[model samples]
Target chain A: EPEVTQTPSHQVTQMGQEVILRCVPISNHLYFYWYRQILGQKVEFLVSFYNNEISEKSEIFDDQFSVERPDGSNFTLKIRSTKLEDSAMYFCASSSILAGVGEQYFGPGTRLTVT
Target chain B: GESVGLHLPTLSVQEGDNSIINCAYSNSASDYFIWYKQESGKGPQFIIDIRSNMDKRQGQRVTVLLNKTVKHLSLQIAATQPGDSAVYFCAENDNQGGKLIFGQGTELSVKP
Candidate 1:
């Protein structure tokens, strides 16, 4: 089965540096999303992208966060300035269509560690 | 502002036994629910889902029961195996889009 794929399975960056997490969603998928989980915390939604634009976002997705679909296949989340709290497992997910009900397939996830 | 939460933090069951994990949602408007399984460092893996209109749905060795009246959901796994040891999470979708509110998660350990 086709699945979402993310690059840099694990990332380590300095506290004030900028970082980009990349994802290649399923070729035919139209909707893409980003979620994060702090160690020992529930997975939290960050933002959703469709038509190369943001559809919905959470408080955690503040000024430091931005998402881009620079190409037909790549969806990326960039943090302007990484913070210690930004250290978590970031996941990318995608769904094919909006049929009132469809499953969102998740990637293995990129573990972001900020020093 | 609504949140999805689990009742239990951990559950231990013997291999070949059944397991039940429960969840509660604060939003009555939420209509879609899903159950996901996550191993140590992996992402949440989809298990089964149930709509608010329906009371129950079954898939493979798992069954999902939704009680919209009380805003509750549960996952039942039959004949659990050692591989079933993982953290299970219940998620609720308000249906506005694809956003899902996930529960705290329940750690399930199937003993051999």
Candidate 2:
């Protein structure tokens, strides 16, 4: 089965530095999303993208964060300045609207570590 | 180190036994409910889902029951195996963006 794929299974960066996390959602899927989990905490929604614009976002997705579907298959999340609190596992997910009411598929995730 | 579910609940079952995980959702407007499994170092994997119009849905060796009146959802696994061990989460789908709001997870441990 085709699955969502993310790059750099793990990322480590210094506080105040910029970082970009990349994902390739399943082909032909129109909707994409980003979620995060703080260590052993519940998964939290960050942002959702569709039609090349953000449709919904959580409070955690502040101005420091931005998402772009730079190409047909690539979706990326960038942080202008990383904070220590930004250290968490970032997950990318996608689903097809054409399929009508199906579940989203998730990537393995990118573990972000800020020092 | 901080623990993810130090305060969360856990269920232990034998390999041949059945396991049932439950969740109490907070959204009444949410029409879509889903159950996901997350192992260590992995993202949430979709197991099964049900719509608000239905109360019961079943998959391969897995069944999901939803009580919209009480906003409760449960996942039942029959003849649980060692591979069934993981943290299980329930999520409600947003109306607009296909975003999911996840619930507190339950740890399931299957002993062989």
Candidate 3:
């Protein structure tokens, strides 16, 4: 199975610092997404990327958050100014165009700890 | 400490027993649903999915049942094993670019 992969399994950054989380989605996937899970909470959608543009985003994805597909294989989420509340497990997911059925392959996730 | 999967609804079952987890979704427009399993520190792994037109879908030892009328979804694990211990989440898709909305997960503890 070709699974999504993420770098820096764990990230620790000071408050107000910039942090970028990287993901390499399945090679053939066209749609990408970002989500976060606060400790002991349900997963929340952050943003979705397709064709090098943001397709959809949640309120949680505010001005501080941005996503970019700098190259063919790498997708990244950058938080301009991290806050304590930004500390959570950030997950990147991808799916094929037949995504009408909504089966997304998720990476192991990057644990972001903002202190 | 607030660990992942720690505050989720939990079900304890003996080895070889069958486990059924239920979920209630709020969206009537959702046309797709998926079941995912998450280990303590990992991301959600896709297990099985069902389209709105289908009432039941099966995969390996798992089965997903969907009821569009009541907006309910259920995952059935047959002859559960120790490795099946994890948090299971049911997610609904709004049919818009495959964005999934997850429900509060249920923790399954298969006692061996």
Candidate 3 per-residue C-alpha lDDT over A1-115 given as tens digits, one digit per residue, 9 for 90 to 100 = 7999998999999999999999999999999999999998889889998888999898899999999999999999999999999999999999887466547899999999999
Distance (Å) between predicted and true CA of B4, model 2? 16
Model 3 TM-score, all chains together: 0.95
The Cα RMSD of model 3 versus the native structure comes to 3.7
Sorted by TM-score, highest first, which candidate order results?
1, 3, 2
Q: Which prediction has more favorable lDDT, 2 or 3? A: 3
Better of 1 and 3 by TM-score: 1
Candidate 2: where is the Cα deviation over 4 Å? A98-100, B1-8
Query: Where is model 1 more than 4 Å wrong at Cα?
Result: none
Candidate 1 shows a clash count of: 0
Candidate number with greatest TM-score:
1
Q: State every prediction's TM-score relative to the real structure.
A: 0.98, 0.94, 0.95
Model 1: DockQ vs. true structure:
0.66
Local accuracy of candidate 2 as per-residue lDDT tens digits, A1-115: 8999998899999999999999999998888999999998899999989999998899899999999988898999999999999999999999887212888899999999999
Task: Report the CA-based lDDT of candidate 2 relative to the real structure.
Answer: 0.88
Mind giving the per-residue lDDT tens digits that candidate 1 earns over B1-112?
A: 6999999999999999999999999998888899999999898999998888899999999999998888889999999999999999998888898898899999999999
User: Residues B1-112, candidate 2, lDDT per residue (tens digit)?
Assistant: 1111212469999999999998887667778888899999999999999988999999999999988887788999999999999999988874655778888799999999
After superposition, which runs of candidate 3 have C-alpha atoms over 4 Å from their true positions? B1-8
| Whole-model lDDT values for every prediction | 0.94, 0.88, 0.89
